[model samples]
Target: MFNGEISASSLQQISPVSFAYIGDAVYELYIRTNFLLPSKKISDYHHKVVEKVRAESQASYLQNLYPLLTEIELNWVRRGRNSVNKSPRRLPLQTYQQATGLETLLGYLYICDRPRLEYLLSQIKIY
Candidate 1:
């Protein structure tokens, strides 16, 4: 829902973790919107969304995005990757870092370049 209301410089000052916090919501919303089932199987939809939204899945998405990202986007990824100090014990640190990087990039684009974010999200190969 965020558009050009905020200036680029102001967006730059937001922390990667803050961006990721919002990005996690935004991405989950997107997945829920696009992947919802017409049937009454709520659990099925939940499982599918969980599969796609997990840290490992996000890390895979980030890996696929690397070749397509602009330098500015890559810089945001690096910022997010470097910002992680710890992760849950169940997940490898690198996977969490990469997932955070994806979230950061998504959040940045959502605020500063909505069309770009939509394009990237559409490019994702979702079942």
Candidate 2:
């Protein structure tokens, strides 16, 4: 677990892909914790988690957050989007890029600004 101890300069040195890597895990834990009930079957939990974490779902979440992002936040997203060089075969390139952008931004906030990350995650429509 990151303690948010990294300096701003150091944070900048971290690659967008690296951010996306952490973001993917962070977002998954968040969704599983906040959105799912433990009473549900294990299979049900897996399906719901999968639905929320998919590229298409992530892209939509990014679109919803666009109007609310600050210039700095948008910059992080652009860095993530532009950093994408490859994507899974089943997904469209644009959708995968957008999803990566969202993940990158989430990862950035997770590392550099927990308050903002919580705010953005709260805004996500998971239902």
Candidate 3:
């Protein structure tokens, strides 16, 4: 398994689904970290984390973040958004697409550049 940095070109060649897979994990962890507090109940924390992890929530986030993304970042988002895939019945297709796009972009940054990923997450209000 790749436990190290991957080249940008190589990363780009990987399937968008693969990117979204890892991106999903990374983003969930990011949200969880911010919500961690001893004072908060486990159930409360779980709910808060779930709120951000939903596809609709991610889609909304992606929409608001367009102006903040760089051209390259936006390109990755577009690549993910355009990927053809079926969505879970609970969420709308557009929301799934946008969420996958955001996740793929996050995974791309997480692999290729940690600083950039941190910078992008920093731009958002994770709470």
Candidate 4:
């Protein structure tokens, strides 16, 4: 079995915002790659995908879906949510920051080779 451990030292080295940055791309790529068809117009597909992948949308998703998360997952989300340093933004502060943390956790899990990403995606009752 693969020892799916993320080192504390490695986690400490990465900024929460940086994790969110990579995560936003990773999550969107997952959504776009999964939902967009080869036959569809690229522009139209991208527009449709962006609606779901934006920070606000993701934040809403996380809030509604928070109850479904495991204890460990909740901790990860909290770490990202409570991270002190942040980028400047025009969006609502709380939602945007929470969403950033959500994305960061998702990105972390993706890199950690954890099955939680797929599991959480599968459990999502919303589209």
Scored against the true structure, residue 109 in model 2 reaches a CA lDDT of 90
Model 4 weakest lDDT span, ten residues long:
118-127
Can you give the TM-score per candidate against the true fold? 0.92, 0.95, 0.89, 0.78
lDDT at 80 for candidate 4? 79
Clashes of each: 0, 0, 0, 0
- Cα lDDT of model 3 by residue, 1-127, tens digit: 5566777688658987788898999999999998886669889999999999999888888888899898989998998988847899997888899999999999888877789899888877765
**Model with the higher TM-score, candidate 1 or 4:** 1
Candidate 1 regions with alpha-carbon error over 4 angstroms: 1-3, 37-40
Per-residue CA lDDT of model 1 for 1-127, tens digit only, reads 4547887788768998888887888888998888765764888889989999999999998898899899999998999999997999999999999999999999888877889999999888776
lDDT of each: 0.88, 0.92, 0.87, 0.73
Tell me the alpha-carbon RMSD of every candidate.
Answer: 1.4, 1.2, 1.8, 3.3
Off by over 4 Å in 4: 1-6, 84-89
Evaluate residue 24 in candidate 3 and report its C-alpha lDDT on the 0 to 100 scale. Answer: 95
What C-alpha lDDT, on a 0 to 100 scale, does residue 5 get in candidate 2?
A: 93
How do the residues 11-124 of candidate 4 rate in per-residue lDDT, one tens digit apiece? 778776677776787778777777655668888887878888877788887887688877877877877787734545767678777788778778777767557787766654
Quote the lDDT for 83 in model 3: 84
